[model samples]
Target: MKKTRKLIYLLEDNDDIREIIAFLLTEQNYDVCAYPTVKSFNEDIVLGKPDMFVLDVMLTDGNGIDVCDSLKSNQKTHHIPILMMSANTQMFTVKEKCDAEDFISKPFDIDDFVKRIHHYMD
Candidate 1:
């Protein structure tokens, strides 16, 4: 039997960036669900859990670190791998606090982004 494709949940406020990233991941044969805010993401959580989560550091509603923290703390979702992206140079401090599985600074190379995702998936 064929294996089911893994799903990736992406929480990004920027539409252009989100589309580009989604396109990249889709090209790589991963299913992606993109959300512009935590509120939207929360609504989808009940529908299904993705194999991994890609979160941005900042959002119009609040910081993504809090979202990551909540997911990591939740018994059902804690084991899901998180890949966090941030434009802030201070993101390392927040990353340390959140204990995310992986982090990427914004204005990042697409190759590096894909590589990191592949690394974590492995």
Candidate 2:
């Protein structure tokens, strides 16, 4: 049987960031579904769960940490690895509080971003 490629669910409010990350992940052979908010993400979960999640720390609707907490707390989705990104490195405390699998600061190196995605996807 052929193995299925892992899917990555990305939640980022920035259009440029979303496009760039999506392009990068696609090149790396992962299927990506990008969303701009928790509401849309929640809606998509009903369709199917991704192998992992890439979440932004801030959104127009609310804090991404809160969304991460919700995903982690839920039995159905808790197993999915979550990689969070933030522009504010100072929010390391908040990132820790969320208990994400990993955290990447914004303006991050492309190589580092790809490495983190591969790390979690693996």
RMSD for each of the candidates = 1.0, 1.1
lDDT of 2: 0.90
Model 1, span 1-122: residue lDDT tens? 99777899999999999999999999988999999988999999879879999999989887789999999999999999999999987766977879789888998999999998888676
lDDT of every model, 2 decimals: 0.90, 0.90
TM-score of 2: 0.95
Q: lDDT score, residue 82, model 2?
A: 92
lDDT (Cα) of model 1: 0.90
lDDT of 2 by residue, 1-122 (tens): 98899999999999999999999999999999999888898889878879998999889888889989999998888999999899989766866679799998999999999998998888
Q: What local lDDT score does residue 31 receive in model 1, on the 0 to 100 scale? A: 91
RMSD of 2: 1.1
